[model samples]
Target: MKIAVVGPSRLPIAPPFGGGLEVFVHRLVSALRLRGVEVDLFAARGSIGHIQSLEFPGIDWTGFEASARDDAYPPGAMESEAAAYRRVRKLLERSDYDLVHNNSVHPAMLVMDPGKAPPMITTLHVPPQPELQQIVDTLGPSNGRFTAVSRFTADQWRIPTPVDVIHNSVDTDQWRPGPGGQGVVWFGRITREKAPHIAIDVSRRLGLPLTLIGRCVEPPYFRKEIAPRLGPDIRWLGSLPPEEIARTVGHADVALVTPEWDEPFGLVIIEALACGTPVAAFARGGVTEVLKDSPAHLAVPGDVDDLVRAARAALQQPREHARRTAVRRFDIHTMLERYLTLFEGVLTR
Candidate 1:
C-alpha cells in the first residue's frame, strides 16, 4: 500500500531528533517501508535520505509551545506552519495513496471534508488544544479514526468515538544496557513544561551530579530557570545524537523525568528503561501507566520531596527488572504489528 505520513513541520524526521515526536515518525516510516509498504513522508526540510519526502517550507518552530496557550506561536510562526499543512492536506485529498497517517497537531489538515480524503488516522501526540478542539467540535464525533500515545491523553480529549491507545515503543537493541555509573541523568527538551530545572533541584538533594541532555528551545525559561542553577555538579550537555543518547542513558545510575505539564506519554521514561536505567518520574498524565509494571519509581505530581524519595528508591531497583520491563512492554516489533493491523483494518473498512 502507498501511504502519506505527516509529522511536525518544526524539525526533519531525522536525527538528531528534536524530541519524541520526530523519533516516532522516523521509526514509523522506516518500519512501514521495511514491511513492503510505500510511504511518502511529509516533513520539514531535512529528513531521512531513503524515503520519498514532500518537504514543508522551512520555518523556525523552536518558539512555539502548546497550541492551547495564547503565546504558543511567535509572529507568523503559526501562519507558516498552517499554510504548509494545508498545502499538504490539499495534495493528500487528490493523491492516490491508500491511506494517510497524520502525526502532526496543526488543525489546518482537519479543515478538509472526511469524505474527500483517503482513510486518515490521526495519532494524538500532543495535549488538547483549543484550535484542534474547535475543528474537532465542528466535525462532530465521527469525523475520522484516532489514536493516542496514552490513555490519559485519549480521556483528556474526550473524543466521543473510540480512540485506540498505541503507547510509543523503543528498540531495545539500540539502547542496550551498560555498567551504570555514579551520576544521575535527565534528558528531553529543556523547555518550561519539561522542567529540567526541577531535575537539577532533585539531583542536588540526592548529592549526585546531574547531566542534562537535549535541546534548549525556550531561551527565557532556560535563562531565568535553568542557567542560574548550572554548576559543575549540575551541567547541561545540550542535545546528542540517537546512539550517543542511548549510551549516555545506559551509563547513568538513574534517570529523572520532571514534566511540569500533562505529558501525553513520557518517551524519556521508556528510553531510560530500555537502557536498563531505572527511572524516577513525576506521576502525572501517562507516566504511571508506562511505569506500572516496571521497577521504576513514581512520585506524586509536582512534589519535589516525593520525587526525591522516588529517585532514592529507584537507585536500588534491579537493573535487570528495568530491562525486562522494556523488552516485555515496548518492543518495537509489537508496535509495528499493531500499526500494520490498524492500517489494514482501516483500508478494509
Candidate 2:
C-alpha cells in the first residue's frame, strides 16, 4: 500500500537524531518500506538518506530562519512551518495514497482542509500543546485517528476522542549487549527539564563516574547547570549516531534518567535496556510505566538520596535481565505490527 508519512519539520529524520521524535519517524518509515509498502516521507531537509527505492522523500520544510534561533518557541520558525504546511494542503489532497500518517504534530497539519485527502492518523509523541489543542478543539474531535507514545500522554489530552497508547521502542538488532563498565550514564537533551544536573549530583553522591551523552539543546542551561559539574569523574559526550550511542550506553553499568517534567515516553530507557544497561530513573510521567516490568529501579522525583539508592539497586540487577526485558517488551517488530494493525483498522473504518 502507498502511504504518506509526514514528520516534524523542526529537525531532519537522520543520524545523530536531535530527539526521540526524529528517531521514531526514521524507524517507522524505514520499517514500512522494508515491508514493501510504498512510502513517501515529508520531512525536514537533509533527511533523505541512502535508504530505499519506493521510499523517496518529498517536501523539505527546512531553511526557515528564526532570528532568535535557540529560544524555546522560535518566532519565525513556527510561522514558516505553519505556512509551509498550509501550502502542502494541495499536495496532500492530491496524493492518491492509501493513508497519510501525520507524525509532524504541527498544529497547521491538522488545521488544513481535509476535503479530498486520504484518511489521516497522527501519533502524538508529546503531551498536548496549546496550539495543537486549540486546533483539535476547533476540529471537534473527529479530524483524524490519534495515538500517543505513552498512556500518561494519552490521558493528558482533554479531547473527546480516544487516543491509542503505543509505547515507543528501539530496533534491538541495532543495539547489542556490551560488557558493562564501572561508570554511570545519562543521555537525552541536556536541558533543565531533562535534568542532567540531577544525574551528575546522584553520581557524585554515589562516588560513581558519570558519562553524559546527547545534543546540548540549551547551552545556557548546560553552562549554568551541567558544565561546572564536569570533571575527571564526569564526562559529556555530544550527540552520536544510533550505533555509536548504543555502543556507549551498553558499556555503562547503569543509566540515570532525571526528568523535571512529565516525560511522554522515555525512549532512552528502552535504548539502555536494549544494550543490557539497567536504568535508575525519577518516578515521573511515563518513566514509571517504562520500568514497571523491567529490572530497573525508580526513585522519588528530585530526591538525590533516593536516586542514589535506586542506582545502587539498579547496579545489582543483572545485565542479562535488562536485555531480556528489552527483547520481550520494547522490540521494534512489536511496535511496527501495532502501527500496521492501527493503519488497517483506520482504513476499514
Candidate 3:
C-alpha cells in the first residue's frame, strides 16, 4: 500500500530532538516500510529528505514540504497550515495511494476534498487545541477518520466523530539497558506541567544524584518553576541525542516521570523501560495503562513521599526483567504490525 505520513512542522524529525510525536512518526513509517509498504512523508521544508531506505530493507522514503508562507506561529499558524493543506490536496488530486495516514493535529485534514482524496486516517496525539478542535469538529465528521493516542485523551475531548485508541510504541531494541550505572534520571520537558520539581524532590529524598534531560521551551516558566529549585545534587544535561539518551537511561538505576497535568502518554516511561531502567512515575493519564503489567511502579500524583517509595521499590527489581518486558510488548515490530492492520482496515473500508 502507498501511504503519506504527515508530521508536525514546529520541530524536525531528528532523534533526541523532537518529542514523542515526531519520534513515533519516524519509527512507525520506517517499520511500515520494512513490511513492504510504500511511504511518503510530508513535513516542514528542512525536516526530512530523501532516504534510500529504512533499516527494514524494502521501505523507501519520499519527502514533501509545506508552502513557504505557512511557516510561522500564532496569528499565521492556521493560514500557514491551510497553505500546507492546499499542497497536500493538490498531491492527492493526482496520486492513487491506498491511504493517507496523517499524524498531525492540524485542520488541514479537514480541508482536503474527500471526493478526490484517498481514504484518510488521522492519529490525534493530544486533546485538540481550541482552534485546532474548531477545525476538526467542523471537518472531522465529514472527511476524516480519527484515532487517539490513548483512551484518556479520547475521553477528554468528547469528540463527536468516531475515535479509536492506539497506544504509542517504543523501539525496544534501541532502548534496552546497558551496564548498570549509578544516579537517577529524569527525561522530558522541564515544565511545571511535567513536574520536574518532583524529580528533584525524589532525588533529595533518596539522596541519589539526579540528571535532567529534555529541552526548555518556556524559559520563563523554567526559571520561575524549576530553576530556583536546582542544587548540587541535581544537574541539567539539557537535551541529548537519542543514543546518548538511551545510554544515559541504560546506566541509570531509576527513571522518574512526574507529570503535574494529565499526560496523554508518557513515552519516557517506556523509553526508560527499554533501557532496563525501572520507572517510578505518578499515577496519571495513560501512565497506569503503560505500566499495567510491567515491573514499573506508580504513586499517587504529586505525592513526593509515595513517589520516593515507588522509586525505592523499582530500584530493588532486577533490571534485566524490566528490559525484557519492554522488548516483548513495546518492540518496534509489534508497533509496526498494529499500524499496518489499522491502515489495512482504512483501505478495506
Candidate 4:
C-alpha cells in the first residue's frame, strides 16, 4: 500500500530539531518502509534523507517563543499555518494514496475531510488543544478514527469517538543497559512545562549531580529559570542525537522526569527504562501508565519532597526489571505492528 505519513509541520522530522512527535514520525516512516510498505513522508524541510519526501513549509515554535511578548500566538504564524494546511489539502486532493496518516495537531485537521480524502487516521499525540478539539468536533464520529498515544490522554481529551491508545515506542536495541554511574539524568524540551528546574532542585536536594539534555524552546525560560541554576553539580548539556542520548543517559544511575504539564506520553521514561535506568517521575497525566508496574517511584504531581523520596526508592528498583518491562511494553516492533493493523483496518472499513 502507498501510505502518505503526514508529519508535524512545525519542525523538521530529524532528531535534535523536533520533539516527541517528530521523533515518532521519523521512526514510524523508517519502520514502515523497512517492512516493505510503500511510504511517503510529508514533513518539514530537512527531514530524513533516505525516505521519499514531500517537503512543506513549517513555522518554528522556537522562533515564535523567542519573539512573542505574551502567551498569545505570534503575528502571521496562524496565517502561515493556514497556508500550509491549504497546501496539504491540495496535495491530498490531487494524490492517490491508499492511506494518509496524520501526526499533526494543526490546521490539517480543519482542512482535510475524510469523506473527500483517502482512508486516513489522525493520531492525537497531545492532550486537547482548542483548535484541534474544534476540528475533531466538526469532523464528528463518522469522519475518521483518532488514535491517542496514551489511555490517559484518550480519556482526558474526550474526542467525539473512541480514541485508540497506541502508546509511543522506542528502539530497545539502540538504548540498552550499561554500567550506570552515580547522579540523576533529565531530558526533554527545556520549557517551563517540562520543568527542568524541578529536576535541578531534586538533584541538589539529594546532593547528586544533575545532567540536563534537550533543546530549550523558550529562551526567557531558559535564561531566567534554567540558566541561573546551572553549575558544577547542575549541568545543562543542551540537545543530543538519539544514539548519543542513549549512551549518555545509559550511564546515569537514575532518570528524573519532572513534567509540570499533562504530558500525553513520557517518551523519556521509556527511553530511560530501555537503557536499564529506573525513573522517578511526577505522577502526572500518562506517567503512571508507563510506570504502573513500578509504582513506588511515582510521587504526587509537583511535590518536590515526595519526588525526592520516590527517586530514592526508585534507585533501589532492579535495572534489569526496568529494561525487561520496556522491552515487553514499548518496543518499536510492537508499535509498528499496531500501526500497520490500524492502517489496514482503516483501508478496509
Better of 2 and 3 by lDDT: 2
Residues 223-283, model 1: lDDT tens digits: 8999998998988889899999999889999999999888899999988998989999998
Q: Which residue pairs show backbone clashes in model 2?
A: none
lDDT of 4 by residue, 1-349 (tens): 9987888766789877558888888888888989999988877777775233346555655556666322345667667766766777777866799988888777564456656778678888877888777766776774477898999989877578778899999989889886688589998888888988999999899889999999877788889988888999988888898988898788998999999988889999999999999999999999999999989999999999999999999889888988999999999999999999989887887
Cα lDDT of model 3 by residue, 156-248, tens digit: 774667688878888876776776667899998766678787898899899998989987655666777678877888888898889899998
Per-model TM-score on C-alpha atoms: 0.93, 0.92, 0.87, 0.94
TM-score of 1: 0.93
lDDT of 2 by residue, 152-213 (tens): 98888866678888889899999999889868999988777899999988998888898999
lDDT of each: 0.84, 0.82, 0.76, 0.83
Q: Tell me each candidate's RMSD, in Å, in order.
A: 2.8, 3.5, 6.2, 2.2
Instruction: Please give the clash total of every predicted structure, in order.
Output: 0, 0, 5, 0
Assess the local accuracy of residue 301 in candidate 4 as a C-alpha lDDT between 0 and 100. Answer: 95
Report the CA-based lDDT of candidate 4 relative to the real structure. 0.83
Candidate 4 lands at a TM-score of 0.94
RMSD of 1: 2.8
Indicate the worst ten consecutive residues by lDDT in candidate 3.
Answer: 54-63
> What lDDT score is found at residue 214 in candidate 4?
90
lDDT of 2 at 105: 69
Instruction: Give stretches of model 2 more than 4 Å off.
Output: 49-75, 294-296
lDDT of 3: 0.76
